[model samples]
Structures are given as structure tokens and as C-alpha cells.
Target: MSVVKGLLYPLPLLIGFACAPSALGAFLKDSKLNLNLRNFYINTDYREGHAGTSKAEEWGQGFRLLYESGYTDGKIGVGVDALGLLGVKLDSGKGRHQGSTTLTSDGDHAADQWSRFGATLKLKASKTDLRVGTLMPKLPVLVFTDTRPLPQTYQGGMVTLRELDDITLTAGKITQVTGVASADRTGMAVAGGRRQSNDFRFAGVDYRTRDNFLLQYYQAALEDYYSQQFLGVSHIWKVTEGRSLKSDLRYFRSRGIGANAAGEPGYQIAGYTPDHRGEIDNDTWSLAFTYAVGRHSFMLGYQSVSDDSDFVHLNQGSLSGDLGARGASTYLIAERLQSYFGRAGQDTQIAQYSYDFAAKGIPGLNVTVAHQDSEGIQSFAGSSLRERETDIILTYAVRSGPLRGLGLGLLYGELNSEVTPDQNQLRLMVSYNVELF
Candidate 1:
């Protein structure tokens, strides 16, 4: 079914439960509703006219209504969750509507509006829970992108177990994804693979050591595409009052599977290295360190991708040139605007700083600046490929009054690359959240 149909498929159930509240008194008593209003504007000026375009820009307003219900009172409790999303174009022209980034394309222009809705059925038993249906998952092995007007969601079943102290286990299977600007669901595909896969499976374990250390391990597979494993660890130590140090480490290994390994026609990924092996084979690692004292924080990080291929992740854009159904994200700290620093043989270094004006008695205000430099990207072939990006961000929120939940955020970024397009980007966002009983 299409996203619209799937979203509306459960409306009757919601209406029935709402009408007969007495039949599910527990659910009604624990149910909660929240609505979020968001306005977003984005502009990108291509310094060298990459993608054969001088600039891309779009502005839109979004509304999201989320309803979550508490489980019924029983050893095996049942509940439901619903999400409704609407996006209206405020300003977007054909010249600014780049495929799969800001808005869905309508021929050479952008669609006027788009909407989607979804529901999840959930069951709970003791400390474990089972959820089946539309989901937004944030796992080490897989993450859903939500940087646009609407967040991406998946059709799947997920189970979580928290029976053990200090440890949690999670498992899931995903079949389809609904993009942020889409009214239909699409199968899963990798960055360069043209063929879509309906099966993506993952399992993971998370362990906490004491109160300041965490360890994670996860395995994932995209059928006939690639199999991946990830391991991560993080720790924080308080050196003194209002002072601390932190460290984060992550690693990933990917290898081709089935058809991809067999070199089936139209099954190869894009940007393979050294004679176009055309198979998924990569090993990547990243480490980051941070220190914070008073109102200031600083970070230094490094990441390196294997020489065989670019760091790979699920990217629906490979299937088409439309901006509506294309979204992807990664856990790499080096990931920045328009680039993940993930090209084959790439090595990236990062520096960042942030401050909270609350320390200066100005509450609800913060500022951050960051820079990343990368080299040795294999895409340049015989020539050396290097890139750099600088970004600044500001954010604030209203603390009280009728607009207590209102927030504003601004981001400006400049990127220069030897092997890719150079660009300047800006983003302005405003949001308010309200709860309805």
C-alpha cells in the first residue's frame, strides 16, 4: 500500500477507541497528544555550480501530531501510537528544487504540499516490549534521518529486552521506508546499488559500565547488498568540579553479500576503487575526545575510510533523482553538511567549540563553531583530493509565557573541496510544541 493508504488504514481503529473510551479505559487514561509546528528555510549557493546549478533554496512549514498511549493494565499490555505529518511549501521554485534534499520534485519544480500518517501497534510484557508498524529507529547499525520538514519512518517489527541489569538487547526487521517528503513507501537500497531490498535485519546489545561508560555491539544486513558490524565505546570522567573529559570510539566493517558478491548485473555499488571491484568491502574507524570546563567545550576527532570504497550506508537517492524519497545518515562524527567525509581512502580531522550563554546569565541561548578537513579521497585518482568545511550555529528557546515552547535555530556553513562542489549554506528554523489532552 502507498504511504497515504497505510497511514489512513488505522484511522477507523483510532476513532473506534476514541468513541468507546470505556472499552479501553486504561488506554484512554494514559494516552497523550502533542503537536509540533515547525518552519524551515534552507539556501545553498554553489560556489562552482555543482550539479549544473548555481543555487538551491526552499522554505516550508510543517505540522506533526503525535499520539502515544500507555499499555493496558495487565501482564501483557497492549497500546498504540500514531503520527500525522503535513508539509506546505512556502517558497520554492524550479531553479531551487534540487532532487531529494529539500523538497519533492514536480517535474522541474517542487510539489506544493505533501502529507503522511502512520500507526504502530505495541505490546508489553514485564520489562520487554514489542512494537510493529511505522517506526523511527536510532541504532548504531542503522539511523533514520530527520533533518528535513518530516522525519523518515520504516515499516517493521522491533523488540527490546531490558531484563538484565545495566544491559539492553534489541532486534528488528525492516521492510520499507517512507521518506520525509514522500507519500509512498520504498524498498531499502544502498548508496550506489540500483536494486532495492525488502529485507534489512539488525540485532544489537548495549551495556553500561558504572554510570559514565557505555559499550555497544551491533550487526546488520541488507539482503543481497552488504553485511555490516559495528562496535562502539564511550566514557566520561569528572576531573573536578564543573570540569570533565570524554572519549568516543566507533568502528565498522562491511562486506558484500549474495548478488552483490556475485557481481550480478545492475547490482554493483557506485564509486568502487582499484579497477572497479564493484563489491562492498570497507573498514572504517573514528575516535573523538572532548574536554569541558566552565561554559566552554572543545572537541578533536579523526576518521578514516578504507581504500576499497566510500563509507557505505542506506541512501534511497541511488534509485532516483527526486528529492522526496532520498535520505541517509551515519554515526560518523565527521559527517557534515552535504558530505560525510566518507569517500574511499578518505582521512578526516575535526575541531569544534561551543558555549552556553546561560553561564553569562542569558538563559536559553547557545553558540557553536566547528571545522573539518579531509584528504586522500580516492575519487581524485592521480591527483590529491582534499576538502574542508566550517560551520556556525546559534539556538535559543523561550523560557516562559504562552510561547514558552517556542524555539529558534540558525546555521551557516561554508565548504571548499578539490574533488567536489564548493558551496555556502544557511538554515533558519522556528518551532513550537503544544500538548493536548
Candidate 2:
């Protein structure tokens, strides 16, 4: 007891004084916090872009305030993190209303204001930590969806433990979700909101043996919504002293149970599914390979889905790049996000190439191109429906000067479809940020 107390007696003081000795209170001169500002532009209806290059010109401004406090301790360590997020209308409205980004509420310009925030309490002991309240769960089981201007947050408690070599364990329960793009918090549920569930639970284990190998397993459940299981394996091996190749394989399977409680009998996929079924079943797989030589790297990946209906998921259909790869953001005039354009034989494939400019004297500059081919839709034919796309993206950032960290992106695309208008698009974006602590 004497030894234990001696060791922990300095905790509170350290926390109180930036991890000082027991003599210090909870105030430390080195403690810090900061504010950051980000300005963004989004325009989807530019006569010079979409239908011309996939570039839609839209814009907005975001403000974030972050605060963190060290712990004051004894046997327990305590800390807090607070965040304030505010997004104001800068350049979004009808005619140029890109999509469901809340850029426009009812046809006119979006309200000039949108904001939200959350607070968290953290406790630490040895190498383990417990956190409660608002969290941005990043684990694969419940990674907060952040494919927008803002990031989504969840209300939950999570535990991370690491006491064994080559192994780590994690578990958590989430009850609600606050979308990064909206002001309201919605209850957790399976895809479509019909198979609603509130008690989101998950647990996982990861192992690494100091080599180029990794293994992972996780299971997640949404009380009355659905259950999912995941398994992953990856590794990198040296082909030669100066050359290596790496491969990653991932698989996920999901089934429904108590998803739809109030929906019609057949429409109980999860508990109260929207369509039909007492359960939901899906399997997804991805195979990727990379080769590295000198300062250059090459990568290739393929992913596919095998189901008549769109794979079920949370209200936001983010899985499966159905919205178009390269961040088309599920808004390519397709009507909604995750709108899978598939038929009985619908398949998607990706081919990409990249170059590193740093090897050639220039830093922070690169280019990439990808093409997607979709067939087996069994539904479209003739000169009315063509399904194919070729995309080009060029990006550069200023490393110094007033524009340090300033980035510019130019994107272009070519779309060919039988029934829809063949469209070409282009887009340009400029943004910067500053920190005030």
C-alpha cells in the first residue's frame, strides 16, 4: 500500500501542474488550447464544371474551438475536452445548391448559421483509458461518418485495454449520433432508419507481431437493429533488399435480428426493415496490392457486392463507393447518397496510377487518374444508356510563404450514359487555416 500510494500521490499534482508532483494543483502554465478557422467552396452547378468536369463550385466557412485539460489524480486521472463547431453560409444556395449539404434549406440560400458542440470526460490508469460523453469513435466497427464539411459525433462510452504483447482489446456502447452536416442528433439504427436500434455495442481484438503482419476481428450489434462481424489480415514482405510488395484482405458479413419492431411482418429485416425479410445478410470483400521501389509506389484494388438489394447500413449509406469514387460524395445527380447503380450483374472495378514529385525536386505535388466501368445492369441498353466514367485529379499545396498549407485542387470527369446527357465537368477549390491558442 505504501508503494502504491507513493507512486500515485504525484499524479494529481502532475495533472494539476501539467503532470507535476503532488505539490501542484490543477493549474499548469504549459497547458494549452487553440482555435482554427477553415473556409471551403462547393459549387456543383457551375456551367463551367459539372456536365463539363464533375467540378461543382460550392463554398462555406467553418470555425472550431478546442479545449483540453490535463488530469488531477490519486488512483484515478481525469481530463476534459470541449469542442465548438460553427458553419456559416458563404456561397451556397438554389441554382447552385450542390446537394443535401444543407447548402439550401428550402430553395433559397441556406441559413447563415449552423453550430453544435460536445464535451467529454476521460479517465486514465496505467496504459488503459476510459472515455465517456461525446466521442468520435474511429474504430472500424463504428467509425464516425465524416464524408462531409463536418464530422459526425456519437454519444457513448469506450474502453481500450493493452496489457499483453502483440494484442489489444476494445469495446464500447453508443446510443445516439450527431451528424457533422446537421444540427440534430438521431438515434442509432441500421440502413434506412426503419430497422431502428439504440444500444450500439461493439468489441474487437487486434494482434501485431512486430513483423509485416496484422490480424483483426470485431463484432458489432445495434440492439434491435442488426449484427455484423469483421475479419482482416494484412502484411508486407521484402521481395528484395530494395523492393517489397504488400497485400491487404478484408471481409465483413452482417445479419438482421430485431431490426424492425413496428414495420410490416416481412419488412422486419433488422427489426422493422423498410422492404421485406426477418433478417439482413450481406458480404463485402476488398483485395489490394502495392509494390514499392525507390521513391515510387504502385497500388491496385478491387471491391464488390453480391445482393439483390443495396447492402443495408445506417441511415447514411457510406459503404460501397456507389456514390462514385474519388469523393463525388454520393451526389452526382443520382438523387441521394449510396444509391447503388447495380443490377443482377452490376460490378465495379478501379484502375489507378500515381507519381511522386518529391523524387523530382518538387514537394507536396502529385497527380492521379482512375476509371470505373459498370456493366451487368441488365436494365439499360442501346444508345440510351451508357455506363462508364473516366476521372482526372490534380492537386498542389504551398509549402511556405503566406499560402503555406494553402491547397488547390482541380478535378475533371467524363460521363457517358445512354438515357442521360453525356456530361463533362471541372472544379477548383482553395482553402487555408490558422491556429490561435
Candidate 3:
């Protein structure tokens, strides 16, 4: 929970120079600046009791500014992208500021403020682009986390090509990541590793059909950690005028790599698995079906993880010194509030229902409820471990007047687990965005 000072000081200087009309030539004329004002609050009540603390709650205000410059007038266009973030603590005391969800702890107390700045250099040529800097990538294999006030960011270089119709190719190398609650960047690691790996490289391709079919494949490797491959497919079939069904399938395979496979105990991941092997050998797959009728949608899914190892993803808890960071996320729908449901030999079933109020003359409003059940976790022997979670979310947006770009969201979740503590969580957020030229 160490906050990096002076990390965002360069942002104001860069903004000052870039915003000057006379300095950037055509870059200034075509640039776009957007600012988001966000207010967030979270409350977590530990049901099993949290060792002298029963609840953790915090509230904060966040500011996110993004500036993107259009490609300069040339065959090989060049531009710069910058991100500026600032978070202000609105309310938090010693007992409630344990860094559960909202704010990072600083010497037994939450920090008063935190800020970060990042910039990207870009080059574009004939529908292809290369960018080297901070990025937030949302892919099947690696998705950035944005569940909190500020989104997570990664330091890396990526190349994207879309020269072919209905297809996209991407590749990147990421060395470090900055978590949502911290200003400092750390090396990448799995759930429980004593060290970090500076090398996390990936490549992928996505192909889509005109008839609403998509296919994807990606491969990634974290040096001395694990090598992972992902495959996904999605298809949408229209049943009638206002009815449709979507089918989504995803799979992942992970195994130890480099030192992780060299029989060295120091390279192994940290977690409970079959026989306490702590190795990276797992296969997981999930399939989901969704049916939509007018403004209503229903979804069901099933997921299975292998019996030898837990599902793996890019996690950095090992770099936090005390191993206290628990803010890891993935694209899996089974990742609930208290658990990822990714333990070895786990099978998960999910159901969801959502409705849009626009059809009922209440535009800009939506509600969703979901439930997930997971069983057969290896951590609990004998009768097999089981966990269940129920979540509800509501969102609304201002569609007119002075608050046209304002939005509000609320979420509530409850978790019951056989091997872990049962808990309840709530989050409320309000956001507004403005464009500055």
C-alpha cells in the first residue's frame, strides 16, 4: 500500500504544452479531452468477524482526465495520448480504512489523496497502429479491472492491425501493472508467488462474421511463471423480430514455464491444490447462453476447472510485501464478490436476468440480478466444498438537461461459502463526464 509520490506531476506540464494552440500544430486542432468526475462508496460487512473489526467502509471522489491527439498529417502519423487521475478521500477513519475496496491504507490510515499520470506515444500507418505506454486492454485472456473508482492500468507496448475486413490482430508485451487502489506499479505474478516476472507477452486474433459470429484465440506467457492459451467463440441467432439468442464459449489451458517447471520450489505458485503441489497445471472452460426478448434478457452458464490446479490469471499480490492485495479480476462470469470460484476441481453454474426500462417509457434505466453456485473445491475434502453468491445491480443515466452525461449505479452482493467466510458487500457510484476542447 505504498503510494508513489510525484508520479502524476508530469501530467499538468504535458497538458499545458499540448493544449497550447501554437505548440502542437495540427495535433492540437484535432485533439480531444474528456474529464470524468466520479464519486464512489463501498461497505463490506464480514459475517465471520474480521478479528476486532466487523465492517470496512470508505467514500472517495475521483477525477480521470484523458487526452488523445489525432494522427498528424502524414503517411506515418504520430500522436500522443495522456491520462491523468486524482483521487480524494471524502470519508474514512482508522477502523474503516483497512483497504478492503475503496482506499489504500497508509500507516494504519487511508491516504488523503493519490494521483497518477501516464502517457502513450503512438504511430499509425494504413489502418494499423503501434502504441507504447500505459494501456487498459480488454481481451479474452487478459482483461483490465475497472470495478472501483479508478481503472487499473498497465505499462507496455502493443501493436494492432485491422487491415482485413471483419478481423483484428493484436500483440503486446506488458512488464508491469498499477492496481486500482495503488499509485505504484509492480511486476506481474500469479495468485501466490514470492517474486515477480517482468515479462508478460501475448498475441491474439479475432475474427467476426457478418452474420454475428465471432472466433478468437490468444496465447500468453508470464516469464518463469505460467504459459496460458485461450480460445473463445460467440454467436448470435435472431429468432424473430425482437427475439434473439447468443451462445458464448471460452476455454483456457495453463502450465508451468521456465523456472516454474524446473523442479525449483521457489518458482512455484502459492496456493492450496491437490497434494499441495502448488504447480501451474490447469484447464478451465465455460459456456453461456443468453436469450433476449425485447427489453428483457436471460442468461445461463456452466464452468469447470481441472482437479489439479486452480484457475490462473495475472495477479500481483506477491509484490505488495504483506501479500494483502486481493483485487484480482478476470473476464470469467463466475468471479463473484468473495471468491473467484476458481479453485481446483470446481464446477460452477450461473444464471442471470436483466431488464431495460426504456421499453416501459423509463429510458436510461437498467436492472440486473445474477446467481452463481460452485462446488467440488479441492480445499475441502470429504464432502466437497461449495459456495454460492447472489448479486443485484441497478444503473441509471440522465438523458436530458444539465445532467445529460451524469450516471448512477448501485450494486449489492451476498456470498455463502463452505470453506470461507460468508459476507455481504455494497457499492454506489455516481459519475459525470465533460468534454473540453
Among all candidates shown, the one with the greatest lDDT: 1
Flag regions of model 3 displaced more than 4 Å.
1-23, 49-52, 263-266, 322-326, 380-383
For candidate 3, lDDT tens digit of each residue in 256-327?
888877646656676556556678899999999999999999999999988877889987766655322336
Residue-level lDDT of model 2, residues 1-437, one tens digit each, is: 34224323433443443344562355333234555555555433222323533434456666656666666555677676666666667765445553345332333335566667777677778778888878887665666654445567788899898878888899988877765555556565544443234688999998986987989898988776567787888899999986888887766676665634333442343222123444455555656777877657776766554453334445532312221111222111111222233222334555666666778887778776766655443222321123566767777877888767576667666665433445565555555544444
Q: Predict model 3's lDDT versus the native.
A: 0.82
TM-score of 3: 0.93
TM-score of each: 0.94, 0.75, 0.93
- Candidate numbers, best lDDT first, in rank order: 1, 3, 2
Off by over 4 Å in 2: 1-32, 45-57, 102-109, 194-196, 261-279, 316-346, 376-390, 397-405, 410-435
Q: Model 3: which ten-residue window has the lowest total lDDT?
A: 1-10
lDDT, model 2, position 326: 14
Model 1 Cα displacement at 372 (Å)?
0.4
